[model samples]
Target: MTDRFYSVIYTLSGFAIAPMLVLAQSPVILTGVVEDESGAAVAGAKIALVQQISSQTEETTSGETGSFRFEDLSPGNYLLKAEASGFDPYEEVLTIRSQETKPFTIKLKVGSVKAQVTVTLDDEDEVSTSESNTSSMRISNDLLGALPTDAEDVVPLLDRFIFPGARSAEGTAILVDGVEVAEMDMPSAAISRIRINRNPYSAAYQSPGTGRVEVSTKRGHRSHYEGSLAIYARNSLFDARNAFAKSTPDSDRRLVQAKFGGPLPGRRSSFNVAAERLMNNESAVVNALTLSGPFTMNVPTHERRYRTFTRVQWWPTELHTLYATYDFKDKSRENDKLGGFNLPEQGIRTSEFGHRATLRDTVLFSRNVRNELFFTFQKEEQRSGSPATAPAILVKEAFTGGPSQSFGREKKETFDLADTLTRARGRHSFVFGGRFR
Candidate 1:
């Protein structure tokens, strides 16, 4: 019995040890050199190893030789930023292969942070109040608290990607704790801080003209539980109308939202969760072909979205920390067909449900080579219903025992997983990995 018991313990321990052995066998490294355009060493420069869409930065200072090195980073794409107080920020993009060390190099230049004349517009005073066009927009917490929305939706406002028109039309990317946001379609549940790279002067970003947008979410926690809500709207009573009692142009506005998140267990290794909801409704009348004749069709719509997330952070050793994150989201919409009594018809109505889940396991193999693996899944279901025709009024035409009611439903699901290893050597960071779908 004693021998059998020992054997069982041994088997379990071996199971845990096997993954580490597999991981130990693979250690990739990245090396790089940083110099000035004048071919001069720029010592004291700060070199930051930043992940794809996150604010977490691992930094190293240049040696007296103007050289920098980072070791043991998990395999993944990384953005390198080299900055000096008196010099323009120098950034470059690089990819690292798992268990593979490669050499990378960069050349810095001296330049002023002069106003970009290429921006084409003068807006030093522009506060960026407009946010109705993009899928995501960022706003100050104070501003978010000040605004109002009918649905009490807050994700759209909190995650709003606010910036000069520096984002690409396809949209910038976002991340939370080194995880890719755009690749994950950025579920609102895991968002914290956001930084948009609209025309980023840094070469580290892959998108042309620095068109990508990146974001980060607050993980674990420094504070306890905290949440807030926002709502905004404007009606005819608040607008100036003409003597005809007709609403003047620009007399329509509506919005509402709310967001709440905080620490589950505040610390280096803890847990936390956040959630947000939002909704909007608005109406307007345009006078193009007719004098307030409503040439433009009148349309009405209702929309809603919800997001939730949970995360765990663990660190048993100074060189290692484990993090796991999961999130889910649901969105739906319906509209009232706009037109005239000429051929009045019921507006279209549709509803769609979607969800996503992800699990990431990260272990610090070394200061330069971090080992991480991620699993993800997504699902979306769309079911649309159209107006049931009046069974055509055929002459003598009323057919008895006409068509009966028909009903249906549809759904789809997708799954994906990724494993990676990274190591930073010298000025180069290498990310070697693979993904499955």
Candidate 2:
């Protein structure tokens, strides 16, 4: 990173787009063909994810061919649900691994329609939680909005969502959908629900747990959507209790964001859409006297960020389903500093911006085998140069270093692509994947 390095700006188009970039799962997927009574492949069933350990829940619909798939789902204790027009829905509990796609063939017994089915999976039975400290906590739908935030900043970002004063939670990995949610541009508020797994994972899963956090977003469900508009701002409400509390002048800040989404109708497909804009501005203060008389300098900081998403699903046949998604985003920040003296004083300003898009599809050839193909494109551009300063007729100022003149901008681009395949049998499940630059 450099002062002149220009990064592409992420811009959100009109309409509500999922703020899901930060939590989107990989397009790669695993399909669980579901069948109902009479050994008939049931279609139009509903499947929901129950976090075995935390008992949190998220829902998606099953496709035709008595089958349903878990797409972009992270590793956790997950189960399945099978539904029919005039029959009782069936629920099954199973474990889903990271980067691994496993298939299940489930048969449901005929039951009265009036009966309510409930399934529970306890992860503690398999993964020991006997000797772990600093537990991980997940906040979902209700809690997400209920909790307070500073200008709707990124979740777990800038060390937020962490215990106060706690240093870095290293060994921490956040999985969104199925891909790692490591990008800083992702919005934490977009997460519909989260699951936190701690250390001491089971031997069956020879994986060590860090401050491991798994997140899921709104996807593949009928009539599911969310939208919100907010205005957040703060002015110098100094209530410093401690002495020598790095005192400073009072300042004000403000931000606004809106989002909404729902399920796409398909026998084996899922869909979602969301959009948001976060605008922030803060005032800086300084009291002093320049070469002239008494005066005060006040500088305002401005930051703008926006995100959008539009996706659809096509399950033309049982063996093949198409998932198409498009996303666009733009973010920018600017800082303006002024002098305390004459109203017209020389000042410096800086700003930055990022962009990304992706498309992918998954195919289930047989009960135990699957293939995934997808590609993502990204670019960044930035512009930073000091604007011409207004003339100061007061005392002449001399150069401290090189002559103060205009500076040019620098830009950079990045490309990423990947493909994966998976197969599952009785006790052994295997997955292989490769990526292109």
Candidate 1, 1-437: lDDT as tens digits = 99999999999999999998888656566666777888887788888888786656788888787877787676677888888766788887777666666666667777677664321211011111122224334444345335562343443443344353655565554444544444433334345544443344432233535334444554554366555554455555665554322444333344333444454443446566666565544432322233234344334556566666666666555555555666666665554332232111333456656666666666666556666676766677766655365552222321212221222457878776667666679866576777677
Model 1 RMSD to the real structure?
27.6
| Model 1: worst 10 consecutive residues (lDDT sum) | 121-130
Off by over 4 Å in 2: 1-137, 155-176, 180-182, 187-189, 195-215, 223-254, 263-271, 287-296, 316-321, 336-348, 365-368, 383-410, 425-428
- Tens digit of per-residue lDDT, candidate 2, span 324-379: 54556676655444323323234344444556555556677776677666666566
Point out where model 1 deviates above 4 Å: 1-176, 181-190, 198-210, 222-236, 240-268, 284-300, 336-346, 383-410
Give the least accurate 10-residue stretch of model 2, judged by summed lDDT. 121-130
Looking at model 2, residue 331 earns an lDDT score of 66
Q: List TM-scores for all candidates, in order.
A: 0.47, 0.49
Each model's number of backbone clashes? Answer: 59, 32
